[model samples]
Structures are given as structure tokens and as C-alpha cells.
Target chain A: MKKIIIASTSAMYGGKYLEYLQPVLQEHFKDCSSLVFIPYARPGGITHEAYTAKVAETFTAIGINVKGLHEFDNPAQAVLDAEALFTGGGNTFLLVNELYNTGVMQALEKAVHAGTPYLGSSAGSNICGLTMQTTNDMPIIYPPSFKTLGVVPFNINPHYLDPVEGSTHMGETRETRIREFHVFHRQPVVGLREGSWLEVKGSAIVLGGDRHARIFRQGQEPEEVAPGADLSGLK
Target chain B: MKKIIIASTSAMYGGKYLEYLQPVLQEHFKDCSSLVFIPYARPGGITHEAYTAKVAETFTAIGINVKGLHEFDNPAQAVLDAEALFTGGGNTFLLVNELYNTGVMQALEKAVHAGTPYLGSSAGSNICGLTMQTTNDMPIIYPPSFKTLGVVPFNINPHYLDPVEGSTHMGETRETRIREFHVFHRQPVVGLREGSWLEVKGSAIVLGGDRHARIFRQGQEPEEVAPGADLSGLK
Candidate 1:
């Protein structure tokens, strides 16, 4: 059984990491020993120690032990030590590039499939797909260009949002992005909103968030669905 | 000889079509009686007649009579009737969508390889590459998800430009788009600037334009290049 909780980001507006992790932090890690972070994506480009310390601060605030992945050097052993793993957000492109370059992507995917509880936000949520083609932003950063973890068959369009009124940027709207995706593909994309998330436990998929999920299939209007609902559209 | 000209647009900014057909254009079309116009892409959502007629107006101005594919019910006859083919610009996604839907892409590819002179602008130029993954506007209007004409091994990011300063929108920049493309695959992308184009006659491949061309190989800065330039970078 696969166990993963992929989220949009670790913050809602100005909310801290704890705010975003509140719902899942305790429930998924009641028996976990430590938290390891992969923070190669800071705008300032933080060191692994500093990035992990930040996560440690958040974990300590909630009375849990935490560490950064860099400390161990052996990423596979680091994964072995953790009962659960938490990946923070920065730029999706930046995060994915580092993961590919350092071979952390393969390690993380192996660990998660081996029963480690995987938690990710924003860019971190993005790497869980078969390809990064569905990302909402431009696929700008390139680091070795390896395929992603392949957790799901479809692409992810992260930070998915409705277009602002009367914009002049000359790009397609979110709906069009999804539709264009359909042209290249035949799979259904779960247009996860800002607060929405996908929770995978064993073989079951559950959605949790404040708003309804928008599911887009080929040749149809995207429909809205709620938490715990069966994704008949997905199949 | 496979005669191909990848242009920036059917009509460049502030310029009429065929008004600027240069030594290269004349070199490709010794006789231009049967010209094919593929106008499936409409960012402005213009009709096939309107877009195709606009292309014909340009060729006729140059004393080369042209006909749109829509003038005939069957597109194969349209392909067969052409001494030369000119695909106009609007939206690469829409253009390719219509081509794939109508099965004109395969016909055009066959015609070009069969020795017909092929001329294209903007969206038309984009279709020459392996995929429409890097076109300028978001394929928000339609899916450009065709196998494409495949004259070039790479993708074409048309109307390529750097971002303006003080912009509020946080979407990915043009450079970012190219990099994002590299993340998924190892193909080089031709960042054909507005004035830049490609002229293909038999074994000769020429990059024709005013500005320096930008080519992105995986994990490197986009290298600057020029017209009649060698594109071993593309392979």
C-alpha cells in the first residue's frame, strides 16, 4: 500500500509551515522518529543544514523530532531512519532540478514506496507525478532532465488558479491549460486547488481541503467534487 | 530537395505578408501557383477563410497566386493542388489542433518531403519542430498536441522575448519556459526570435533573420547563433 500526502504548499497566504501541516502532522506520524527535509529550493539557496533547521523548528514547536537530509550524507540510510518524511516548498523547478541532480528523487521514491509516510508541499507535491509537464509555471530550470518519481501517470499543474480578469500576459487560462494537456494526453488531471490536497493510503485516494476539487476529462466541462468522494472521473 | 522556410509569422508586426519574401523565399518557390494555407490556430479565434485569405493577399502582392486549403472541401486536393504551401500564424496550439483534427499535418509533412516548397510564419514556424511544447502563447485556446511536421528535431518557442521590468505577474519567463522543457526531455529548443527564421532547400539548412538565434542544450545557457548558421546544437 502506498502512503502519501501531497499538498499545494506549506503555507496559506502568510501561514507558517505548521499552519499547513496541522491537519496531517500528528495523524500520519504518531509512531515516526524523525523528519528529514530536502530544501535545495530557497530563493536565497539555503544550505541543507539551515533548511533542515527551519523544519526542525516547526517540528519542535509541535513536539516532534526533526532533522535535515544533508546531515546523514547517506540518503538511503537517512530514509531508513525516518518513519515519515516531510518535503518543504520553494520553487518547483528548483526542487525538481536538485532532486534529479543528486539522485535524491530515486531514493525518495524508493523510500516512500517502502512504506515511509511521505508528505510534500507545492514543488514537492509536483515531483510525485510521471512527468513535470503539467506544472502551471514554465518548465524553466533544467538539472540533468531525468524523469520524475512516477507516483501518478498524469502531469501536475501546480499553483493552479483561475485567471485574473483582463490580463495582458498573453498566456492561456487554467482551463485552457488543462484542455491543452488533454490534447497531448488522454488521462484525467485532478485540478487540485490551493487549499486542496490528495491523500493516498494503501490503495485508497481521498481528497481534503476547503474547496471542491475540479476534475477535467477529455471533451467535457470540469466537474467539482468533495472530500472522501470516489473519483469516478479519474478512472 | 526538401524546400522549407520557417518564418516568424505570415504577417510580421506592422508588415504585410509576402511583402518581405526575400532572396530565400524566391529561391524556394520557382513557381507558386498552388499555395496551401493552414490556418487552424486562431488565438483571436479568427475563421479559416479570414486567416487563409490574409495569407493569399500577401502572396498575390508578390505576383504569386495562392489558394487556401478551405477553398476546396477535400484537403488532399488542397495539398495536391499546391506548387508551394504557406501556413499562417495565429496560435500554434489552435493551428496544430485543427491540422491534427483534419489530418492535414501528415499530408503537409508528406508534401514537403515530396519536394513542395513550404513557407510558414510564427505559429507556422513552430510546427516545424518536434513538438509545440515551447510555443509563445499558452495553448489555453486549444491543444497543439500533434506529432508535428518534424523537419527539425527540437521544439519551437515562438515570439520569444525576455520579460519587461516591473511586471507584477509571477508566471515563468521565456528563459524559464525553455529550461522547463529540458526537464522532461533532452531535446535542444530553438528560441527563434520574432524576426528570425529557417530556410531549407535540399541539403542546405539556413537560419535566416536579423537577430542572433538562441539555442538551449540541456544544462547550459542558451547559446547565441546566426542565419546560415550550423545547428549541430539542434541534434
Candidate 2:
């Protein structure tokens, strides 16, 4: 059984981000002895060494014994040594490129299916989906293809929101974007809002977050998903 | 010489939306003789009768001959007759899905290449790309595929924006999303800020708006594009 814990933050060590999320991460990986952190998305320049280092320090203080995988450029070896893999979020494109280039994404998929604990945050959480179709970023550079790491069956929309009032931006609203997503992707999107998370343990799915996720199937009005709801219904 | 004018709104007559985009529409298509509105996206949700009289009234009041082409269910004829086609903004998924399902996307593509003067707004602009890879919507639903009416060589990030100061929203910022778009799409994205537009006349690409549209390319810093600037440099 693959125990996947997709969070929204890196470790705090002595800091706090989404303070509500810390307990959930700790409780989810209580049994794991060590957690491996992969921080490769800094390439797009959204992430910095200071934040990554802080993540390392935070995990170590919590006794998670976290190590940065950038040290082991070898893709196969990184997977072989990791007990529980934790991927911190940065830019999904940067992370996806590194994983595809290094073959670490395929390796992690193998390890996850083989019952190794896998942890992911924002960009990390996005890679868990069938495609990175729900990412809210622009394509600044070019790669071989637009496909993403297909670690999960559904699409993941991080920081999903309903439209806010008095907005004059010419782009479609958040709801409209989701509706468009429903029209493009054959799969359902797990609209994971900030401060919320989804945990999968031994085939059991649990939703954890402040706001319930919004799931939209084709041709249906979007429905609200509360915490502790089962995602199998979405599947 | 295809003259495609992608506007910011359509005549959503009977709804409170027509007044919202009237001035912009008037200024853009003031001299255009004819216009064809597409409701193919609504499928069964909207009937032909429901959209025609309403859209016709508002557009005709502006002195432009408006024709809602629900009668020509045939995609080929629809593309052949419409000299100036203006695809309105709606759910892009539904729009692209119907276009693909009825095989109208290619028909539209043919007309565009033949210089039929295609004018698209939101969803309309999206269809002009290699693929709708840079859209800022959820990926919940899937169509026949992720294919679009490849009019423009690149993708369009509709309703694009700069990051708001002290905004609590968490996700990739506008700048980052465009950068991620670069990773997969080597073709530069014409980040059309809301109320912003690009008019292609003969070979002159004119940026029309009060903002700078960024051109995202791989291995390079994105360049800010201004109105009346020669876009040949982008190509």
C-alpha cells in the first residue's frame, strides 16, 4: 500500500507555514524513520537556497532526518536509498523537467507503487496527478513535450478558488477556469485549496484541509468536498 | 492575409454582460461589415433561438450585421460563408470540445489560413494556438483530446495578470506560470492582459491595449511587447 501524503509546505524547523498543516504531516509519517526531500524546482528561479535550507532544518528538528536529493544526481540511486520521499513545492515545470531528465520521476512512481511512502507539496502535489494540466503557471521555456508525471489518476488544481467580487482582470474567473478544465481533461480535478491536503493510506483516501475541495465532473454543477471525505467517489 | 481580431467579450444578450464590453467592441470592430457568433459550445444547454434574437439586437444596434450561425450546423459551410468570424468568450473546454466533436476546428483553421479574418476573444484566442497548453483553467473534463484550432503558433494565457501585493493566494504567480509554459511550449505566449488585444493586419502585428504583453521564450528573459511595435522580431 502506497502511503502518499501531499502537503502544502516545506518543514519549518523552528518556523511555521500553514501551522495547521504541521500536525498532519507529523501524524502521517509517524512510523517512517526518515524522509527524503527533493528540492529541484529552484531552476525556474521561484525557489531560493534560503527557503530550501530552512526546509531541511525544519525537517531535521522534527527528527525526520531529511536529506536533499540534489546531492545524489543519480536518479536510480536516489530512489533506492529513500524510505519515505518528500518533494517540496516550487515550480511544477522545473521539478517535472528535472525528474524527467534524471528519470527520478519514473523511479519515484515505481517506489510509490511498491509501498514506499511518498510525500509531495504544491508542485510536488501537482506531479501526483494524471497530468500537470491544472497548474496555474505560464510556459516560460520549452521542453520536449507538455505531458506531466502521471503518478495519480486525477488532475490536481493547486490553490483552486471560486471567483472573488470586484475583480476586473480580463482573464476568466477561477470558476470559469475550472469549468474549462472539466471540458479539456477527461479526468476529474482535485481542487486542493491552500491549507488543505489529501492523504492516501493503504487504498483509503482522506481529505484534510480548511476548505472542502471542489470537484467537477463533466456536465455537472461543481460540488463542494469537505474534510474527511473519501476521494474514491471522485475516482 | 488572415485578419484575426480576438476581442474581450461577446454579445451575451439578455444577460447583464452586454454592457460590460460594448465600448471595447465598438472601438475594435467599428468598420467591420459582418460578424458570426458561435453558440456551438452550449450544446443542449443553449438553444439556437435563445441566443440569436438577443445577440442580433445588441450587435445590430452597433450598426454591424450580426448573424448567429446556429442554422449552419455544418462546419464546412459555416467556415466558408462567414467572412469575418468572431468567436466569443465562454467555457473554452466546451467550445473546443464542440469544435472538435463537430470537426469545425479544422474548418475554422482552413478559413483562417485562407484569410477569412477570424476574430476570437478568450476561448476564441485559445483555439489559435499549437494547443491550449497555456490556458489558466482547471483540467477536470476531457474532450476528444487537448487539440485546438492552431491559428497562432503559440498559446494564449487569457485573463493574465501581475502578482498582487500582499496577496494571500498560493500557487504559481503569473510570471511563473508563463515561465512554466515556456518549458513545454517553445513558441512564445502572447500574454494578452484583459482589455488587451493583438490585431494582425497583412503582416503587421499591432499590440492594442494599455499594458505590456510579455513574450515568453526558452533560455531567454521574456520581453515586454508594446503597441505599434513590430512583432516580426517575436517570430
Candidate 3:
């Protein structure tokens, strides 16, 4: 069975990195000894080694060993051999570019489909959707294609934010951007706010965390799905 | 003489559509009786005719007639024949896709380079840069290329905003996104705030409006250029 945790963000308000998700992660990785970390996203232009170490600092506390995919001679083979997998957040464009160029996107999809435990946050979580069309990241780089692993039926709009009342900023709101996405795309979009995550097991995808997630289907009104709600219905 | 007005937004805070810009636009389009308006961006999923009418209302007030490119059978030919041009803000990807698909990107570039008076706001202004890589719009559709008109020496990050103090939003700040862009591309970027604009005349590009603009250059600290400052030196 496929087991995965797709989070909107790695940290919550007033919290250290992954601190709020520690309890859930502890149980999530209980069966794994070590997992391969894909640090290709490199948030804030961080190097591969530095990003990997940052992730290791947190995973080590949960009694899990972390190995970066870059350490291996063959990244695709490493994904196939990993007992579990974790992909951190960063620029989605850069992440997708590296995944496609390194040929790890296909291999990683196969590993996850084969029931390897997986964890993803931000740009990492976005790849679980139909496409990267709804990502908030700038186009720092262009990927071979916007295609991603459709592990879930819908696209994940991570770090989803609500419109600020009386704000002077005129940029498109997160909701407006998602609505525009529906103009050209037919897939359903889940607005995953901070502190929220999707727990996928087998064919069941449940909403985790305390807040409700916003669900948007093409040509339909957006609705809020409560915490612990089964999102597999969206499929 | 390469006359152009690149605005951060079509509408400013508490102001009517193109209100603050009318004074400058009146002079910008003084010589032309009518101009071609590109509504390919289609903000908020508005139809081309509807968006064009929106621009037409504002231009008409300034004694300049507006004509949407879509009304013409040949968009490329219309661009070449335009006395002046105005491209409204909307989804950048959609606008870029339409421009490329219709083969008007080249024609528009040619027209602009030949000194046809041009005005662009938001996504429209974004394309006046070297590429649309710095755009803030969602990737609703894939464009044939991120490349755009190099009318200006660098890229423009329209609707640029600063990080809110004490805010907990985990999304990358506007500044952070531009810095990440420098990691792969070596081009200067100007963060134009709402109400601010760039006045490009011949070889000089001057900052206008009431606020300062942020400048990001590769391998250097970001600097703020005051309003009315001539930015031709950076070029």
C-alpha cells in the first residue's frame, strides 16, 4: 500500500522546522530505519549538502537515519533502494528541472507506487499532483515539462493563503490564482494551508492537522473540507 | 525614440483603473489617435472583448481610441500597423502563450523597437523585460518560451512587495524569489511597486511615481532607487 504525507509547509507559525509535525512524523517513519532524502529543491539557494544536513538534524531525532540522494552514484537506483523517501521544499521549477534531468522523477514515482513510505513538503508535495500549474514559485528555471507524478487525483496548492481584508496589494489572491487555474485545467485543486497535511494510505487520502483544507473543482464553488476528512472522494 | 511606460499596476490603491497613470499616458499617447490593445492576459478570466472595453473606457477618457488585437483577423499585421500599443495586465503565462501561438511576439517586438509608443501594466510590463521568468502569475498554461522582448536591458518584477514584518507566511518573499533567479540567470531586476512606473525614452529609463524601486543585480547587494531617479546608468 502507498503511504505518504504531503504537507503544505515544513513548519508552522512560531515553530521550529518540522517541530509541529514531529509527533506525526515519528509514527509515520516508525517502520523505516533510514530514508533517502532528495535535497534538489535547495530552498533559498542552499547547497545540496547543507539542505540535506538540515533535514538530517530533524530526522535524526526521530530515530531515523537520513541519506541524501546526491551521495549515491546513481540517484534513480538510490530511490529504488530507499526504504522510505523525503523531499523537502524549495523552488518548484528548480526541483522539477533537477528531477527530470537526473531521471529520478520516473524512478521515484515507481518507488512510491511500489509502497515505499514517502514524505514531501511544499514543492516536494506539489509533485504529487497532476501538474505544477498551480505552484506559487517563480520560474527561476524551466523544467523539461510541467508534468508530475499523479500519485493523488488532484493538484496540491501548498501554502495556500486566504485574501487579506482591506489590503492594498493588487496581486492575484491565492484563491483567484487557483480559480484561474481552473480556466485551463480540469483537475481538482486542494488548497493546503500551513499546519495541514494529506495522509495517503493505499487508496485513502485523509486530511491531517487541525485546519480545514479548501477544495476547488473545475466549474464548481470552492468548499472547505474539515480536518481528518477523507479527500479520496475528490478522485 | 523608444517611448514606453511600464507600470506596476493598472489600478493603484483606492484609485480608479489607470487613474494615477492618466497624466503620463495622456502625454504618452498624445500623438496617436488610436492604439492596438492586447488583452491576451485576460485578468480574472475576462473575455478579450470585455477586457478591451475596460481599457477602452480609460483610453477614451484620455482622447485615445482603443482597438483590441483579437478584433483584427491578423494580429501580427495589426501590431505592425499600430500607431501606439497597450497591453493590459492579466495571467502572464496565458498572454505569453497567445503571443507565441499567434506569432505576434516577434511582430510586437519589432514594432516596439521601431519606436511605436507602448504602454504595459503588470504582466504586460513583465514581457517588456528579457524574459517572463520573473512574473508572479500562476502557470495556468505553458508557453512556448519564457523569452520576451528585450526592449529593456533587464527584467521587471511588477507588483513587487516587501516581506511583511512579523508575518508567519512560509511562502518565499518577493525578494527571495528574485535572488533565486540570479542563481541561474545573470540579469538585473527592478521591483516596481504599485503606483510606481518606468519611463523609457530613447536610451534613458527613469523611475517615476512616489515610491522607491528595489534593484537586484547578480552578485551584489540589492539597492533602492528613489522615484524620479534616472536608471540609465544601470543599463
Question: Could you say which candidate leads in DockQ?
Answer: 3
In CAPRI terms, model 2 is classed as acceptable
TM-score of each: 0.57, 0.73, 0.99
Best by lDDT: 3
Worst 10 residues of 2 chain B by lDDT: B7-16
Name the fnat for model 2: 0.44
- Please give, for residues A142-192, the per-residue lDDT of candidate 1 as tens digits: 345525676755545555676656654334467776776566566677777
Report the error of model 1 at residue B9, Å: 9.8
- Candidate 1 chain A, run of 10 with poorest lDDT: A137-146
lDDT of 3 by residue, B1-235 (tens): 8999999999987889999998999888889999999999999899999999988998898788999999999999999999999999999999999999999999999999899999999999999999999999999898989999989999999999999888889888999999999988898999999999999999999999999999999989999999999988774
What is the alpha-carbon lDDT for the whole of candidate 1? 0.69
Interface RMSD, all candidates in order, equals 7.2, 6.0, 0.9
DockQ for each numbered candidate = 0.09, 0.28, 0.82
> For model 2, what is the error of residue B28's alpha carbon versus the real structure, in angstroms, after optimal superposition?
6.6
Candidate 1 local Cα displacement, residue A41, angstroms: 4.1
What TM-score does chain A reach in every model?
A: 0.87, 0.89, 0.99
CA lDDT of each prediction against the hidden true structure = 0.69, 0.67, 0.93
lDDT of 2 by residue, B1-235 (tens): 7676654344222435455556756765666777777765442235546655666777787887877766676756776777567676665656776777777777888887788766776767777777776765443334565667766666676666778777766565777766755655577777777666767666666776566777777668878877656564564
lDDT of 1 at B139: 31
